[model samples]
Target: MKQSLLLITVVGLLLSSCSVSKSARGQRDLFSGTWSLDNISYENNSGNFKSVIFNDAEDICFEGSEWFFRDNNSTGRYTIAQSTLCNGGDRFFRWSVVEPSQNYSSQLQFKFIDENRKDISGGYGYRLNIVSLTEQAMTLKSNVSVDGQPVTIVYEFSKK
Candidate 1:
């Protein structure tokens, strides 16, 4: 009876280890894909604007693209940077997305830190916001202040 009990305990330990390993693998897969912005919405003094934003890869310079405003006919490029991922241009500017929680498998909150640019007011040096992530899609929601006023913008991206 004692030998049988020991064998059962060893098998249980191995199974538990396997389960943890599988979970880690799944989390890594979440960020390992190409993403493109699909939609965006925002409000300004004039009113509000909602439209679809497409990633024009041809215009991408250092992994960033120009955001087009369909209604007013305006455009702006938001640059992203990361230390290790940065190809060149500026050392302080690296392009990458940061996950809020360490556990990547669960709902992910992302922040696009643009160390190279300053906010509209010039008081804030960088842009920070929460992002939603899924297997094939990612959405960035910005509730950042510009010129002492609050502005919200949502950008959705999908896997290529």
Candidate 2:
């Protein structure tokens, strides 16, 4: 009788524990890590989409670029490493999320804060909508205007 009661209690506890769900990175703190630029794709005004090709040799300078996110901080840095394509030494610029309250997985607003390069204003910002994100990879989409035409850009990155 005691064995039966013990077995029933154990089974009950196991069944009750099964409902606890694991939180994914998208729902919680998961963006604080180094990420590398994987690739970029863009859509033209006519609703046509195409991937940007790094056909030029100098374009490879950014192929090794990185974006580092600080833990619990909405600020980050865009790091351009020194390469043969670029000899300006290593360059780092301040960047931050315009609004950290919103979900980056849904819609993320980004702004460059380095005033020397360009004027930092509320008017200039980039919007990235996360398409996919995992511990290994993440992809985001940004709608941009080029030459008065709307374009949708998809940026793919890998965690480093």
Against the hidden reference, what TM-scores do the models get? 0.36, 0.54
- The lDDT for every candidate, in the order shown, is 0.42, 0.57
Expressed as tens digits, the lDDT of each residue in 111-160 for candidate 2 is 55552544354446556676766777878777666667778766788989
User: How many residue pairs clash per model?
Assistant: 5, 0
Candidate 2 Cα misplacement greater than 4 A, ranges: 1-28, 44-61, 82-105, 114-124
Candidate 1 lDDT over residue span 1-160, tens digit each? 9999999999999888655344434443554544555555564434553322222112123234322111121112333444453332321221223334563323322222234443333232233343555677766555645567776665666666
